[model samples]
Target chain A: MPQTIQQKFVHQVIGHSATNNRLASKNKIGSGSAPVNIALSKYWGKRDATLNLPTNGSLSISLPGLGTKTQIERLESQNQQTDLVSLNGQRLDQDNAFAKRVSQFLNYFRETPQTFFKVDTENSVPTAAGLASSASGYAALVLALNDLFAWNLDNKSLSLLARLGSGSASRSLFNGFALWHQGQQADGLDSYAEAIDTTWPEFCVGLLEIDVKQKPVSSTQGMQNTVETCALYQAWPQQANQDMQTILQAIKDHDFATLGKTAEHNALTMHATMIATWPPIVYWQPESVEAMHKIWRLREQGVAVYFTMDAGPNLKLLFLETEKPAILQAFKQIKILEPFKS
Target chain B: MPQTIQQKFVHQVIGHSATNNRLASKNKIGSGSAPVNIALSKYWGKRDATLNLPTNGSLSISLPGLGTKTQIERLESQNQQTDLVSLNGQRLDQDNAFAKRVSQFLNYFRETPQTFFKVDTENSVPTAAGLASSASGYAALVLALNDLFAWNLDNKSLSLLARLGSGSASRSLFNGFALWHQGQQADGLDSYAEAIDTTWPEFCVGLLEIDVKQKPVSSTQGMQNTVETCALYQAWPQQANQDMQTILQAIKDHDFATLGKTAEHNALTMHATMIATWPPIVYWQPESVEAMHKIWRLREQGVAVYFTMDAGPNLKLLFLETEKPAILQAFKQIKILEPFKS
Candidate 1:
């Protein structure tokens, strides 16, 4: 029988020995958690949609307190004919989009036709609000699978598996800074994220939530639309890759100005490509623009703060801890997070 | 003495004969008026700053009854060492930016260093509000100059002179539809706008004034910055040329869908290039974005309306006469005008 591309990829990662070792005991429950990450250098276009390979390298910082926790257990009962999935404390129907996606990803790991699993996941952050819950959700799920089967995969292998679920998930596997390589291989084995080992305690992030509602268009679809229609997007991959290098160096040097400026520019450039697309994808709301102007005004006033936006209207502000008082005064409701601190 | 590039270009347009014929008599007060035009296909970059030549062709529709009127008389009085200028019934100081730009433009027309002019201009529309007042301002000044000198020059020569004042002014010389050709010659003699000749009587324009305040960065500086710093701008020239072609064809075919869609896309693409630049130029105010969302929502609801913006936050909405009532219902503050009707 011909193996599906995903199955082939899973086999390549696990190898024959690990594939044969799907755990002798089905009684164990494995639990894992991961933090949501905001990309400083964004991963925009995809080279391979099926394998979730990005066209450009991306760097990100994980928000320590906000993410997802997942617990996975084998369903050995004879009555369990399909995978059971629950989000938060509520069980999700098989046809629910979230549940269906989880089930589809699980298809790669099934030991046999009758083998089933029950997955329970909880998000500390709002789902599909451009906070990248999927990044942490898939990363946590991959870690749980590693623990449940006693596969004991290293971070690199685990990131590879998580990337199959969501492209940004590769970066979510590591705390603090992570760099996802835009690998050259068509097989996509080389394209995975690794920890950027440097930590600056003064680096601070402020979340300004304009909207927590589900995004109108998913990042997966938005990326495809932008790639297909935006003329200006032809310049994005080169710019994005260069930005990744700049940001990577900035992190090492602990240059907040370079990092903040590059991050803001990268985010705006990504949004520019989206706005240029046909049936233009303007993710910014009125408040988003207002917030941008306010940030610019603050910077003009000598406050060293900058912001980056994902595929939605919310903004993630980057600044040093020294400017926290000014930022707090300006944004009354902002939720500040320190990635370096526990 | 070697002539400046502006003098050479102006001399070429007016010719040696008109240069000698700066009117046998200076007593005549020449008066002229022009309508402000909004570009359907934008002219964003400069090939020649001295002669104000554009890098790409543009198309525009003039809004009649909403522009500038001017009267000019050569300052024969010895007391007037500089050109005397007044705008909207108020005399401007010699050092005022507006008066300085006007006096500087008048420099090309001086018969001698001592020959000065008294220029009085009135704008029914808000000045420097992204309503292209400079377009009408230059066109009116050139028309007044033509009349004052009894140049009897055809519309084409007048357009060439108007272009020397401001790039979009070339299109402002004509009513209804105008196409400003992006010429090939280095001397800039071929770079002039002409009437498109075809008119759709149902063609309507709606003005949504989000802000009438002066733009922070002028279009001239904005274009220069984008050209120098924006990577995405590399793709703009080709796309703009293509969009100009699409819009020109749509105008001829009276294809509202093609025209509206192309114009809106063209404007957004131009703005996208600006946003991609370093120290990004974002002209959209919070209210501007709010207006855009309202327009998009109206379009989604089967209202065939599209909007275009220039270097400021104001929006020029495009639609047909048939959709005017619906548009009026949706946008209570919209100032609607019929181009073909006037």
Candidate 2:
């Protein structure tokens, strides 16, 4: 076995002179923060579950200003137990799925290495509220590890590594708009992330969080059920690919109307696929439908607000910076949020 | 009101000696027969319920060999108690929706005439099945009346008359292929039916009636619910219009591939709209999805067959005349139909 270019790069980044000596270093910490991403084109079903590769391509915009901050530190004084993870100041058990996913990805590189690592993460967004909190969390871990190891991997390779942990997390690796490449290879090695363009940035997303008490269906399980049973899921790959292409062109052209149309269609298609599944499931609450109708009616009345949801009741209304006030006014008229009397 | 050329022609065909006589003879009855039409571009919602006008246009091909035979008889008998109606050899109560619809349409022309007439109808197709039995029934009544009165009404005029009773029935007024004209009028007077110039004798439809005992949701109520609740219903009208145009062109060019694609997409969109409705009603029986998937899998495996379904559990497999034998043979191999030979 010879040292690969990636391995050499990792050693150099970590200031190590030799491959064997790399593990002997005491500093195993990584990046301090990573941003959350909102999927402009949603990722629904997976082609390979183990690899977390999607059936169709998805594009997302990383919200650099709003996401979780995480820190990974090697614990020399801690017990032989592999890792201790904490989320927003609360210690999480090692058995937790999110923590386990992080540990698993790290274990891939350091075979039989000491598992004594401490993870401290703080989420800026609401947990389990449909706003890609896990995306930011997993992305933070991926970025943290890459920085800690001095792995000089590009966004694409980091995305590939992050995909094994969570599908949407791969999209969070890049800033602005990112597209998850649905690689043709069987091993999913080529399936990664790339920015659509650096210049396009007028896109602004407003989170209208409907704090419903009920928990919605998790995307991972919901999509898996849909893929396994939904008859319409068979048609989604082709339609999603077409939508991705159309949206990519629309994004490149800065056509908000086309982007909005494509996004709305994609969202409907996703929900339709869910209901078409056997033992039909619905993630929508009654309020979700109400909010959607209100937004739609406002749009029909010539408001420039577009709404999208990801496996939950909360709605994210996308609008231009200039149109935000009008959209917020319309939202207030519908009594969607508490009035700010200030 | 001055009689238009269309009204005069209708009067001449209905045996009126003068336009005034035709207008005065309010109690005159006419009977007509038109074939049941299966939609290539399906209509699922109403824009105006009182006029029975559809939200979108639909394309259908009349089944020449099968339909309803209707007879309308004018009566001088003024006894309200004596207006007996019979359908398919069974005495139908005057309060029955179908009978009431007939009476109402007649009353519209008579406007408090001296007498009322009884209508007798016989349906050749299976009633309450996925097939458009009502389309034939209503079309037959309109056509039979036009013939009995010696009214020289064109297919379009008769279709307009029939549309006042049922939206889809209007499309059945023409033979071979037909299009329902969805005019943008509040009164719906301009909406009628027109014949498409394609006589596709080479095309054949094979019925695979998966007899389910449960009564499916009525298209009328289902469509109303969809309009009032389903967010996706808004897109149906636009897509249906596009599909109708595409299918018409496909029929004209004898392009089975394009025709099949358009039909499949239209059907799927209709079903998707249904699923999006609140309370999430599904007209499909469990076996219907299985049957469709079976045929789809076979088609994917090189069988030249496509399936379309209405608001019922039964499936209609559309295939080219030359490929019917092979398609039927493949269908038999799957044992989709049991106890009956393919």
Top-lDDT structure, candidate number: 1
lDDT of each: 0.90, 0.69
Tens-digit lDDT track of model 2 for B194-246? 98876666787776666564555788888998898665566678778988999
- Displacement of residue B318 (Cα, Å) in model 1 is 0.7
What pairs collide in candidate 1?
none
Query: For candidate 2, lDDT tens digit of each residue in A200-286?
Result: 545667676665644446788899998886554676777678778888998888888788767766776677877555434455554
> Candidate 2: what lDDT?
0.69
Q: How close is every model to the real structure, measured as TM-score?
A: 0.98, 0.55
Displacement of the residue A6 alpha carbon in candidate 1, Å: 1.5
Evaluate chain B of model 2: give its TM-score.
Answer: 0.87
**How accurate locally is residue A94 in candidate 1, as Cα lDDT from 0 to 100?**
88
Q: Which CAPRI quality tier does the interface of model 1 achieve? A: high
lDDT of 2 at A228: 82
